[model samples]
Target: MATSVAKCFLLSRCSGIIRSVTLQGKLPPVCIRNRNLLSQCPSFSYGNRASDNPQDGHVNIPVDRLTVSYSRSSGPGGQHVNKVSTKAEVRFHVYTADWIPEDVRQKIILYNKNRINKAGELLVTSEQSRSQQRNMGDCIQKISDIIAKATEKPHEPSAEDIALRASRLEKRNKERLKQKKLHSAVKQTRRVYFD
Candidate 1:
């Protein structure tokens, strides 16, 4: 009987049909028609031994690390806005965030010192959206943008920049020399010869 039910379940699963079948007083788990479809899903499944290093262009700042809060937004809205808390505030502890690299952490701290509080928490707030979820998303996005900007290395002077600066300096020097020659020539002509 179990074998027959298993066969039916397999056949149904392959045929993209969902049918409930009882086996030993328990219904078999529903099987998906396309097993590979899960790979196309946006959510990713991480392994137990996943690397924490973000050097592979993958930032591992989990949502759990951020502290999220909501409050009533003070803006131009009707009674619904007054009653509902739509503002979202997200706080991230820069000093304690182990996921961020040490160098990047220092850069974030230095670059966003004004935003960071005494507790070393970086605070970001969003109240543009009327919905709490949307405000929360905006807050998270703002924080992520700040972190990205902080982690980015400053644009160093490239070869072209160096060349351009040198050329500008050379041009200024030439202009100054020409001005000086003109002034000297005028001064010589103005010199009264008391013969």
Candidate 2:
């Protein structure tokens, strides 16, 4: 009877029908699923997408440095809101990212100190739309805007600009003095003079 049972178990195992089988103190344990199978899968590639390309945007920050996550958005969407996780959150480690220039990184760090966390990661979130893809795009765009504004250089005053500013200042000063002289003349006339 034991021989027939063992034969049946072996046949089921070989045919991939039984996922796991435990015999009473006689046979070894058998597991059909291998946990290490996922390790053999190919790595993700961020290339080819327009959003991933740094050259297409105003800021040249690479997409690979960003870590994106999703959670359920908090708003009035009823049952659909409860089911779908559409909110997108993007995290970028400014100190560790190698693509950004040192000056730009410093500027970003200084300007966006409020957004940076204890881990030195800039966290940006978006839940404006019901779609996850739109939220992700909004998150990325927000980060790009922050970096762009931080790295922007102030417009230097040219020779013409300096001259124009000087002329305007002189004109204002002259007008102010002329107004003062007219007020003084009025005051002199109103003065109580005894001859």
Candidate 3:
């Protein structure tokens, strides 16, 4: 279970892959909030936020904080693409979620500036799947995940951890230099007598 969360943390950075997870069928223990149950969870940027209110009105967002902007989503929609706004854009305001304090909002805005449009709205859209409901649900799930990330308390590596990382990197650098020197000598031996 802890390994799963670690995998999730590592995979979160990959582009265009939105992972939809349903917590309903499973027991409460598998919930996303419970992902940090490990004794010494490796310091990470996410999965550490304490809490959040899914409600947007309580915060502040256009069209009820979670406005579904319906644009005719391109690709595979075929004729339906021209007719319907099947693509639902789920908007979430970072400053509003109960878990995101003012300071954290600043960080979230900086971290996800690309996702947010010219306006203050953060857009998470679903067009990967065709079903309107599926797209919408997927969009909402992504929005929730983004909100979860926005509320996180940033992780700062401890001095000891930093030193350990530095030492490991130094060792790797020395090994690489030694291998390169040995390779150059092997190349020198292969030189033709015509040289």
Assess every candidate by TM-score.
0.63, 0.59, 0.49
Q: Write the per-residue lDDT of candidate 1 for residues 131-180, one digit (tens) a residue.
A: 76556545545665665666566789999999999999999999999999
Top candidate by TM-score: 1
Candidate 1 Cα misplacement greater than 4 A, ranges: 1-52, 177-195
Clash counts for all predictions:
0, 0, 0
Residue 97 shift from truth in candidate 2, angstroms? 2.7
lDDT (10s digit) by residue, model 2, range 1-195: 222222332333334442222111122223223323223311111112334343432333433456767788998999989999878787889898766667778888998899899999999998988876556546655765676566568899999999999999999999999999999999999999799
**Segments of candidate 3 deviating more than 4 angstroms:** 1-63, 92-99, 155-160, 169-195
Ten contiguous residues minimizing lDDT sum, candidate 1: 18-27
lDDT accuracy of residue 195 in candidate 1: 81
Candidate 3, run of 10 with poorest lDDT: 22-31
